[model samples]
Target chain A: MSTAYGVAAVVLVVLASALIGGFGIRLSRTTSDFYVASRTVSPLWNASAIGGEYLSAASFLGVAGLILVHGADMLWLPVGWTGGYLVLLVLVSAPLRRSGAYTLPDFAEARLESMLVRRTAGVLVVLIGWLYLMPQFQSAGLVLRAITGAPEGVGGLLVAAVVAVNVLSGGMRSITFVQAFQYWLKLTALAVPLVFLLLAWRADGTPGPGAGAATWALPLAGGREYGLYSTYSLILATFLGTMGLPHVLVRFYTNPDGRAARRTTLAVLALLGAFYLMPAVYGTLGRIYLPGLRGGDMVVLTLPARLVGGVAGDLLTALVTAGAFAAFLSTSSGLTVSVAGVIGQDILRGGVRSFQAAAVVAVVVPLGLASLTRPLPVADVVGLAFAVAASSFCPLLVLGIWWRRLTSAGATAGLLTGGGLACGAVLLTLVGGPHTGLAGALLAQPAAWSVPVAFVVMIVVSLLTPGRIPPGVARIMVRLHTPETLDLDRGDWRPRSS
Target chain B: MATRHDDASVYERIEADDRFRELRRRFRSWVFPMTAAFLAWYLLYVALSGWARDLMAVKVLGNVNVALVLGLLQFVSTFLIAWAYSRYAARRLDPLAGEIRAEAEHEAERERA
Candidate 1:
């Protein structure tokens, strides 16, 4: 495959994003637009944008790579990823949108009525956002190096610069369109090449994935220590973690009301389900065609060139490359905006200027970390972020939204314990040598243990400190659980509305 | 016009309101069961993948195993659940929640005046 096609595709995607960001600049003249796009995004467009941003490097490349390497068990990754939205649609979307909180911390402060809990949420949001963003940058580097033979750090730096610019210039209002466009772009990139790849496979007598020892054909084939425990833990993390992602939750706020939020989430489930099917095709084909390929993440990129050959293969590779870069840009921009919003609102000043400055900080910190760290497989790093989010914010959200007795003190304690434990496990997995035994499996997949512990601690603490329940709890609960068409006194506050 | 006493009274009224209770009951009935069922279904998939590998590997069609069909069904089930929720909410949950909200706001407005 020629380098020109790959580089040109990358350049075109960057330019298109920048152009869209500029248009968003004009549309975003008000504080409301910057925060929630004036809360006017329709369900279809919001769903597309959510699809655009949510289908990150992990979905685009990591799932294929995992399936290529791990066989049928890796199918669970995409399943869990899309299924997370189903969980979100059923549990969090309507109530969360009705809560009228712009960010996770806002939801925290409103529900628990405690500044301490709010600040704890803010810190966790930044930590999870950064942890999630690092992989996007690292995968950007990986994709760029694969396509153009550029130094790995260049891709991360390039993507970081583009994302910072996009977030700083447009914020959420601008990103909505950019991400929506990206969803379609990514779909075409992966899906179109897939048709040709399938035809090629059919022509080659429809060989199976090269006689994988029967275990590879089966689930949980890898005889890793505590395999069942790890699978269940991963299921817990991905299923519960979607509601807790700062970026994902922020998108729900863009919907006009709780109904629209629910509709948007429903749309997102469909969009993601359709897009996710294509990666499995690539992964399955990669296994049959390119069995010896190392670094499973590259399967999507390399398979086209191997099967199709010549200019057509190069063109498809470029298309996939463009799609991959768009995945990085869209997801990074979403994460950067969410992280910067929390940072700017809580730590810095409280306006667009502060947000712009914080956006730069948000991207730069992760960009540096991506460069410094040994690049883990993109999906593994993302799974670690999911575990941390599941342990921390999942507990906060589930309990705060449903249980009326939850106190600020209890929320803070739960966040610290669950979040701190998960973060420690992630750091251990990263810095400590490869885990070999029970300790390793536990650290490697902390959500199974950490999430339940967080829930118990929260419930017990809230039960003990019954008097600490906020006086405003009933009012907040009414606001959360009600529909928007209601003329209720759900606090007419629109947070520094323009 | 928005005072501390007014806010407190509004919440007190809502807490006592039968509409609020009924609304909560209806939404909870749907959301809670759906959530539990979905989680159980997901756990079953993961568990089968881990503990019941042979069951998952049973060939369902030409070249497609039970795992592949089940994996595809994960998407199908997600869509079906989402579609079901949309219908249920539109039909049952939303209208009731809206009525409670409207009544609460009406009372709050009366108090403010």
Candidate 2:
């Protein structure tokens, strides 16, 4: 638990990130490279980068912490998160890549032929980006506070500053390399410590995580009221939400083609499945070892030192600390790039300079929000962001890709209705103070009700306003559904130079 | 050469083509059923975890219960589905889509030339 190892780990990760980012900038010379790496990334590298960016603090630290506290029920969080990519792969991956859109708003405009829907989607992208980014910042602070006992704000600021610098320097291309490297680093950090911890437990005669506590080991039996409803809502939010995340969806744009996109997603599913297997191990081990540990988030960091007290334990702790920091940096960098891309394309004049400026805005606003608000448990807050996304963009993407009858008016109404309801529910839960019973559970987990309502509203509205279907719907559908191997005038939806 | 006006009509013609319809149908038929099946499987797992606590808690191994087994199975099923879909896409969806795309592009090129 020495401060020196933790500080060194933080410094090392930052230096490595900066170095990789610098390498990316040198490779990137054109505007396309700045946005989507000129769509040349191979599936393995793209999948690693996606895995790196996708496994945020929620996966690294929060999953273990929640599992440690909530028992088997919390396993759903990681399962739902990984299964989300299955849904993404089966439904959205190829067609979305084939859509030739740089951002979600571009997809909207291309599909609906309406700037209004595009602008609305642009706004939702920024909002969701902020919602997702706030937790990374907050958890960065929490993890730093646990490691070096630094002020909470300092860690968030350090992460924000580093992410902003990385994004502004290399954009997506550099961030890709940085994230891919971080994925391996994170896996080593957790997996290595785990081997030693398990050995130590075996040496100590292999005690279980309090086998006598019946409810603790049982799924949904921990006296959690409305457990059924909450679990279903969590499933809906995560399963459908992966396609809607601004950061996650934007990574697909880096694939060389629709086939590569699908291949990359398949790789992501495998990579993520492998990584997720370790966190639950840490959590279950924590139950027996760190019984008195109150701050559940600190379980991963504290376990190595508690179980193996020596220089080696200190080194292991430092390694996990480095991984935690990597989680914050890689996820924040991805979110910043996606958010800045939207802002640069929509709000500011289109150029790399605007993207740089937008990156600064993207990081600063979330840092400010993290400072102003009370930090919720990292995974819970992230779940709210997923709920909002599942309700909004999931519907839009699914309908936009498959259904030719989808009208602009339908999209706009659905985006507003679904995004608004989910966002309103999230805001109420965050700000309106805790209310127990049905209302609280419903507000806390809005995806079950919100997602279905969003889909129905979209379908009904599109049917009612049949005449509002864009005249170019057929052409757009052809562009989207067709493989990129086809030589057709898929209308250019690239970021326009302003 | 096909004019800009003709390009729109060409896309519409391609959209209405039997090959295009087959390509779309192939993708939808495979993906829709798979999506529904996996989603239903996942939800059933979630529902079982939520409502059937005693069932999930029944120990199948040393300190490993049905809940843990089912949870791990979700991971297995996800990987399985991903693998299956990629194979299906490569064999069934991608090849037919490629053929249709090639034909459409060839038709468009003949009109242009």
What is the C-alpha lDDT profile of model 1 across A34-100, one tens digit per residue? 7789888999999999999999999999999888887777777888888888888878877777777
Tell me the docking grade of candidate 2.
Answer: medium
Residue pairs in candidate 1 whose N, alpha carbon or C atoms collide under 3 angstroms = A65-A296
Cα RMSD over interface residues, candidate 2: 2.2
All candidates: CA RMSD in angstroms? Answer: 1.8, 1.7
Off by over 4 Å in 2: A432-434, B1-3
Q: State the TM-score for model 2.
A: 0.97
lDDT of each residue in B1-113, candidate 1, tens digit only: 56766766666677678877777787789889988998888788777776677788788776688878887898989889989989988888778876766776677777667
Candidate that would win on DockQ: 2
Clashing pairs in 2: none
- For candidate 2, the per-residue lDDT at A12 reads 100
Runs in model 1 lying further than 4 Å from the true structure: A492-498, B1-4, B101-113
Each candidate's fnat: 0.72, 0.71
